[model samples]
Target: MLELRPNCECCGRDLPPASVEAMICTFECTFCADCVAGPLGGVRPNCGGEFVRRPVRPAAALARHPASTVRVFNPAGCGQAEAAR
Candidate 1:
């Protein structure tokens, strides 16, 4: 299951369970569309992978599955050195 992370790793934007703005890499590194499209430049810095829109878990399913409470923030955006790899 996707962790459905609660915030943008790059910019710390709140991305609730149903947010259409959330994007994730295969590793589940979550970031906002702005971060993915702008700073991230359509690439995941940590894994050097492409990103896709995160799926929204239905509200009923969320009650049973529960969205993750952990927040991941990368204030520097994608690390330049890491991205170049």
Candidate 2:
């Protein structure tokens, strides 16, 4: 199951369970559309993998599964993410 991470790793933007603006990689590395499209350039910096839109977990399902609350913000921001990876 998808972890449905709660925020963008780069910009720290909120991305709720049903957010259409969320993107993720194979490792469930979550990011906002802006971060993926702009700074990260549609690739996951850590994995060097292409990103896909994160699916919204249905509200009813979320009650049982629960989206993750852990926030993974990049202190150095998105610009340095590629090199850091």
Candidate 3:
């Protein structure tokens, strides 16, 4: 199951469970669309992998399997990735 992380790892933007803006790499590193398209340039910093739009869990299913509450903000990593780009 997808963790459906609650925020963008780079910019700290909120991404709720049903957010269409959520993107995730294979390792489930989550980021907002703005971060991916702008600073991060569609590449995941940690794993150097591509991102895909995160699938939204249905309302009823989300209730049964709650989305993650953890926020994995990493501004430094984002800066590093941008610099490397």
Which candidate tops lDDT? Answer: 3
The count of backbone overlaps in candidate 1 is: 0
Ranking by TM-score: 3, 1, 2
Candidate 1 wrongly placed segments (more than 4 Å): 77-85
Q: What do the candidate models score in CA lDDT, each in turn? A: 0.86, 0.86, 0.90
lDDT of 1 by residue, 1-72 (tens): 988999998878899999999999999989899888787788877677899999999999999999999998
How much is 15 displaced in model 1, in angstroms? 0.3
Of 2 and 3, the candidate ranking higher by lDDT: 3
RMSD for each of the candidates: 2.1, 2.4, 1.0
Give one digit per residue, the lDDT tens place, for model 2 in 1-85: 9999999998899999999999999999899999888878777766788899999888889999999998888846577545554
Residue-wise lDDT of candidate 3 within 12-63, one digit each (tens)?
Answer: 9999999999999999999999989988877887788999999999999999
Runs in model 2 lying further than 4 Å from the true structure: 75-77, 80-85
How much lDDT does candidate 2 score?
A: 0.86
- Residue 8's lDDT in candidate 2: 92
TM-score of 3: 0.93
- Which candidate model has the greater lDDT, 1 or 3? 3
Best by TM-score: 3
Model 1 has an lDDT value of 0.86
